[model samples]
Target: VNLRSFEQAQLVGSPFIATNEKNMGGLPDRTDDPTEEIIDDLVSGRLPGVLILDPIKAGVVAAETAIKVHPIRKGKSGVPDEQGCIDMAYNCNGCGNCQRNCPNDLDLVEGVRLAKEGDFSVLSDLFDYCLGCARCEVDCMKEVSPLTLLMHAGRERIRNETFNVRVGRGPIQDTEIRNVGAPIVLGEIPGIVAIIGCASYGKEIQELYKMAEEFLIRNYIVVVSGCAAMDIGLVKDDEGKTLYDRYPGDFDRGGLVNVGSCVANPHITGAACKVANIFARRPLRGNFEEIADYILNRVGAVGVAWGAMSQKAASIAAGANGLGIPAVVGPHAAEYRRMFIGRSDDDDTWKVFNARDGTPDQLVGPAPEHLLTTAESIEQAICLVAKLAIRPADNSKGRMIKLSHWIDLERKYKGIDLPNDLEKYIRVEADIPINMKEEVHEYLKQKNWQPRDIVDPTLLKRLCRT
Candidate 1:
């Protein structure tokens, strides 16, 4: 199959659907011809992506698909990847296209070779950001579906191995946020730190851990998912303690929340949606654009995907953008083939329309200039994360929190001087801290930054019917 053409066809709003099969006793048994089942599903246009839920059946699928399988070995008595699973990779021609196409540059050929020899440990770590987007499958010269390999590998490693795997912790619901009252007065919250995305971090992993710790200490609510969550748990501070071990795992302020695997990522965006509908009392049922506009103008949330790769990562970033939440990607994101950077100074670009009404009055100034951006380094990513979290509705304390980190990160990485036009977000002198008051005031004056009051600070307050 020409997967790119197939994806393009699907991209043009093709009505492809996903379906999970029901097996006997709630566990799918190994079928004799798993590839035939997969092909049948594909031809039926009901399987956009295949999710391997059964470990035993995963091997059957892996063998037919000719991909590496690493099902999580279950309990202490669980057996390793079966010998039949190893024999599946005998047809691989040692091509490196799959690895290059992978977001993390994981060598699937070697991984499969290792899996065939019963040593699944070598490629077990590659599952962190296995988006299952099927790009690797299309890249295979041998026409093997690589994601099925990932699922097979994951299933084997998770079900058969005796390693310490981070168990999936379902989605974060809106009621949970309401119970903690974080969404009630979101403006008072400094920022919502969404530490999400792929696990392709370099030295940035250490910096990401410190950044999360800093935000937590500064009273920002931190949320995580996918391999990013796993990476955060794996890091240790100078004192040799992981943030996951030290911090309270709550959804409240200053709490670090890991909302499970990639599929559960909607919970992060769902929390933002609830802020507009539940706390702010805006419409939500069929008003996705308006709710997203409210989030852009009012909610102080930013997504940081330091190691983003895969088409699924792109879609996640795009989804966040559509919801008015901006996402910052790491250096490796450049390999994702595109980045969306908005220019703040451009008046034409800094505008949003109220989808409810086609009137000019309901049009609002864009709260944020960019929806998705890429950082060159870890320090830059931290700075961008702090900057992206700043919204038009931020309170004085919230502005102070965001600016402090912004300036500190700028000084640490770029220079002591703040980036040009940062004063646009500084609503008042009171937003500056007492310690940096002198320096910031001097810089603002030098840049001829005028004191401008933001009247009608609500970006999407005006509502009109079409």
Candidate 2:
């Protein structure tokens, strides 16, 4: 049978026979005997099953669609429910593609081969080498994303193999943050800011951490998870130890807590609830509601989920906003509009704010021009929230202020530096290698600008003038 017919039959779960005849002619010429070579190949075990016309075509089929008919060996007690070989093949092929496409040039293919051979020890190193960017998926013919799949799978295995995986109903162990000197002191603080999202390659996340540190300095409890959390070392450094080691006593009052993996982001919401619960006690309840009212009304506790496609972080932010918490997202303006409005066009719950000046007034207000990095976004969000919290008047007014407004007001209101230490960590074009630095400098110089500076020249003007 032809390859297409064979594929169709396989799809329909049908059994069909092939004959050594051209167009089903009873009398066959030697040249017309198409099945003879295939039959001989199959009988000699040179072919695994039926021989297709071409090896590349056959390999593509096998790689893309081969199913595990049966196990090569039985388990010690019984047959394992999971098909190990099939899993190995699928994962190995994906890993090969990942290695080929990796910009860092890591041996993802060999890593997966070793993993398939049952080497768990190398898994961590293999995964760590991944930039956690999904470039491999773009290059793959099968549309498999290696970084995400491997990270998730590796995390599951590590979680299962290391600690008896337990799901705590409430907050993760407070000691987790305590060890880092960034403990969650619930009622001790007025509010908490959660920085949630995926970590992609580039300096965006590093910038976010600097921002988080600034919030910590301001005594706002900060929670982070997922790749955003990982980017900030929440997974490995449970206690904010690394952070404290770098900036001792920096996080003494406010804390930086790493909840867990991406799945643990909702824990940030729970922590917020805990904060609400703490303030809801008798005398504090009125104050709490008042504070909640202020936060709900003026102060913003925003979540930034740029680079990640999953709208989970953004959704959580909206939920918090519904409960009187404010949120800021870094997704495209349209998506932000969708999340904000939901089904109702009349709902202007989230006062549109942006760091950029020319941002449409209907969707986003201006964000900080310098707060381009994910870390910066987080810090900026926290700073904005902190500013509103500090000002009772601003909170009561129900005004949505740009992050830059608070950044400008930082020194005046709180006597704190507006840019703070976060600016040091923000990677800019000037921070690139010396050779590359010249290129960036030249580019900006030609445009009469500096590195990291926004040049908003109109395309028509530039084109027409040139």
Q: TM-score each candidate.
A: 0.65, 0.38
What lDDT tens digits, residue by residue, belong to model 1 across residues 358-431?
A: 33332223345578888787777777777777776566776677778777777877785776766667667877
Candidate 1: stretches off by over 4 Å: 1-186, 200-207, 238-240, 351-367, 458-466
Q: What is candidate 2's lDDT per residue for 174-259, written digit by digit as tens? A: 33334321122211243456666665533455555665666666556566666665565432235535443433222234666666
Off by over 4 Å in 2: 1-191, 234-241, 244-252, 282-302, 306-309, 331-385, 388-466
Candidate 2 structure lDDT: 0.42
Which residue window of length 10 is worst by lDDT in model 2? 364-373
**Pick by lDDT: which candidate is best?**
1
RMSD of 2: 18.9
Model 1, residue 90: distance off in Å is: 15
